[model samples]
Target: MGIVRLIDRQGNRHELQALEGWRVMEILRDWGMFVPPRCGGSGQCGMCHVKVAEDWSGKVLPPGELEAKVLPLLPGRGETSRLSCQILWSETLDGLTVALP
Candidate 1:
């Protein structure tokens, strides 16, 4: 398991216990963190957008093809922008922090 931190657009912070192999979006939505997951973790809807914390940006895996295609269209897309549904929880992601966009 891992501890994932989510910061909302309003600057509110929420911490959740994330299980291995679970998607970040799943954890956030299950914990009522405000992620819509409109596409049910299918990577189609961009409502699960989150920005990796600058300090931990390199810890998470890079975006795959679908994410690459969808992310750019969202406002404030940047090096840290990522779809929460596409992020898999693992030991490497322990203590990961992200901000809702």
Candidate 2:
């Protein structure tokens, strides 16, 4: 188990219990957060966008090929933008922080 910190659009912070092997999108969705159903965790749709905290950007691996292509076209993409569906939760990701765009 691990903790993942999430910041809503309104800047409210939330701490979630993250299970290993689950996708970040799944964690958010299961916690009642608004994750779009576009690609349904397939990493094809960019709707599950998140801006990784600058300090945490290097912690998570780079986006996959499909996520790489889609992220660039997203509206609020930042230098640390990522597709949540492409991120698999794990012990190493404990304390990871991301903000919804």
Candidate 3:
């Protein structure tokens, strides 16, 4: 299991273990985090957007067609903008931080 920290909009931090093969959004939603997993996390909606910290932002990302479409619609589109629903857990991301904007 990998532990990932999610800093919510109000700056509250919640630590959770990323279930194997589960997207960050799903983990958050399962843990009762505020992320809206609308569009079934298909990347059709930008509801699952999360901001990766400077360090983790540069890491390799999960790829998908819907992920590409949703990234541009997020609040702060950046080189690291990602739909949480698109990200899959891996060992390298155990201590990753994601800020919910």
By lDDT: ranked, best first: 2, 1, 3
In order, the Cα lDDT scores of the candidates are 0.90, 0.91, 0.79
What is the RMSD, in Å, between candidate 3 and the native fold over all Cα? 1.7
Tell me the spans in candidate 1 whose CA falls farther than 4 Å from its real position: none
Task: Identify the candidate with maximal lDDT.
Answer: 2
Deviating ranges (above 4 Å) for candidate 3 = none
Model 1 worst lDDT run, 10 consecutive residues: 29-38
Minimal lDDT window, size 10, model 2 = 32-41
Model 3 C-alpha lDDT per residue in residues 1-101, reported as the tens digit of each score: 88989898899988998867787888888888864766887778888888887889767475577677667767777767788878777887888898887
RMSD of 1: 1.1
Total clashing pairs in model 3: 0
Q: Quick one: best TM-score, which candidate? A: 2
All candidates: TM-score: 0.93, 0.96, 0.86
Give one digit per residue, the lDDT tens place, for model 2 in 1-101.
99989999999999999999999999999998884658798988787899999999999999878888898899988999999998998999999999999
lDDT of 1 by residue, 1-101 (tens): 77999898899888899999999999998898874777998898888999999998888888999989999899988789999999999988999999987
What number of clashing residue pairs does each candidate have, in the order they appear? 0, 0, 0
